[model samples]
Target: MTSRRLFLSTILAGLTVPALARAALSGAQQAAVDRVTDWMKGLKTLSATFVQIAPSGALTTGRLWIQRPGEMRMQYDPPANILLVTTDWRLVFYDGTTKQVNYIPVAQTPLGFLLARNPDFGDEVLIRDVEVTGGEIRITAFSKGNEDQGSVQLVFAEKPVELRRWTVFDPGGTKTVVTLSDVRTNQDIDQELFVWRDPQLFGYPDLD
Candidate 1:
């Protein structure tokens, strides 16, 4: 059997098993994704904390704020003071010293779909699990073998359809956990909040 088929079957099979380590889904749960997606799609602003585990098992944490399908701001903690910002049309990187924001088109960024609610599930992501707990609905997506990507899990809440969290597991077993706590969903955020400017005007662009 080819590695691709083997990988695909493994994930699909897991979706039927009742293990946290494996994927699992229900008919009712399948419907849950639409609900969850709608909730995330409605959100105009969000805040979260993220913990990333690299391939070497080194862990890093950060605080993040995101607004709508476009804007986001993140500040990585300790040993890494990287502040990453983005808008619907561009990604901005803020370094400590020379403060010129690096920009990239949203269309060229894979994260665009990942951050958006109506994700293209057929291409790179497949719904594998859905569950509801307390007031939150959880949806898990495993990347199709062909996409050569990792698994991503998302959590949504009732009424207002607010998204609360997401988990990503890379093929190498590295993990990135994001929690959107103390979030305000559907808040009317100003468009100017997404715009970024050069930090050099302050003469201390890369201050730690």
Candidate 2:
């Protein structure tokens, strides 16, 4: 696949998963995941600037927004020509360069679980591995029923308890890492940000 395609796949991989390296979590590991999950569940809304590094070594920058109960938006920078939005179990990928949008079901992705009203790591979503090192906690997880799909690694900083980065491992075994900066949690993100409309209004081709 091309670099752009690989990168896009990685981004979408965030919500999808396959099999993972099975390991039981220790007391500390369980506590760490609990802490992170608590923080995430409490987040009413979040806005952040993100830097994404694709496995192919391609880099991209974007703005991100998330709300509870399955709502999210990723607006890529110019020349990237992509907008990813998820709402009500639907993930819409808009190709600004081509004026086409592809719709996906959020139920098929692990992300749907995270965006639920109560984000819990339960049957369908299982913890794979946990690592704590140098004030950082990394938790890896994969979807249970879809063990062959892929996995995601979420990195968090301790002490202040902040989410630092996330890495998505796609089915092709490509890792796409996204780092968050200038993060503002529980902010008043405008509802309109989640709306997906035709890009032609912004001077791109009409939606197909």
Candidate 3:
């Protein structure tokens, strides 16, 4: 797979699974899951700087903007020349180097959970594990019926429970880690950021 596709597949994290049983969770674990769910539901808009470690261990930096119930954008720094935008239930990926654009349904991506109007630990998403340590909470999960498609672990700070980072484990056992910094939540984000203008058609502009 191309690097961008790999990155996306890792993010998708096997949302195509047919059916699987939900893991049993203790009361505390259930509470933790609820907290994260509630937090995501309350999050309307967010902007952050992110550092992503690809499966090959290459590190890249980018800016991220998110508007819940269906919009997000990630723009990589120079040399990477990549942009990922999610809007209208579809993910549009633009490769500046190749001047190519590809679209995939948002429902196929793990991000669908975060973009959902009301995210819950329901049958579509199963909590594989949960851990609390060193003032952080980590929740690991995967789509039902497909343990082989890999899992995603979201790390959050305690106390107020803020999202810090997330790690995606691909089917081949490779992992991608994305850490967020300077995160601002419930802030106004320019709606244009989520707009996907095909660079191939419009001529490339400074996307940053």
Kindly state the number of residue pairs that clash in model 2.
6
lDDT of 2: 0.75
Q: TM-score of every model?
A: 0.62, 0.88, 0.89
Q: Is candidate 1 or candidate 2 better by TM-score?
A: 2
Per-residue error for 29 in candidate 3, Å, reads 0.8
Error of 1 at 144 (Å): 5.1
Candidate 3 structure quality by residue, lDDT tens digits, 32-91: 888888888899998899998987778989898889989988888878878889988899
Instruction: List per-prediction Cα lDDT, in the order shown.
Output: 0.54, 0.75, 0.78
Candidate 2 per-residue lDDT over residues 1-208, each given as its tens digit: 7434654576666444544456678899889889988887787887789998977787889888888778988878877878888976798877766667778887665456657777777666778889989999888877766655678888888866777888888777868788999988886877877777666675432221
Q: Per-residue alpha-carbon lDDT of model 1 for 1-208, expressed as tens digits?
A: 4322321222222111112334455677666766765555666676666665543455667766677666776666755545566865576666543333455554333345546545545444556667777878877765444344455666777565676666655555445555555665555544544556554553222312
Give the range where candidate 2 is weakest over 10 consecutive residues by summed lDDT. 199-208
Identify the leading candidate in terms of lDDT.
3
- Predicted candidate 2: what Cα RMSD to the true structure? 3.8
Distance from true location, Cα of 54 in model 3, Å: 1.4
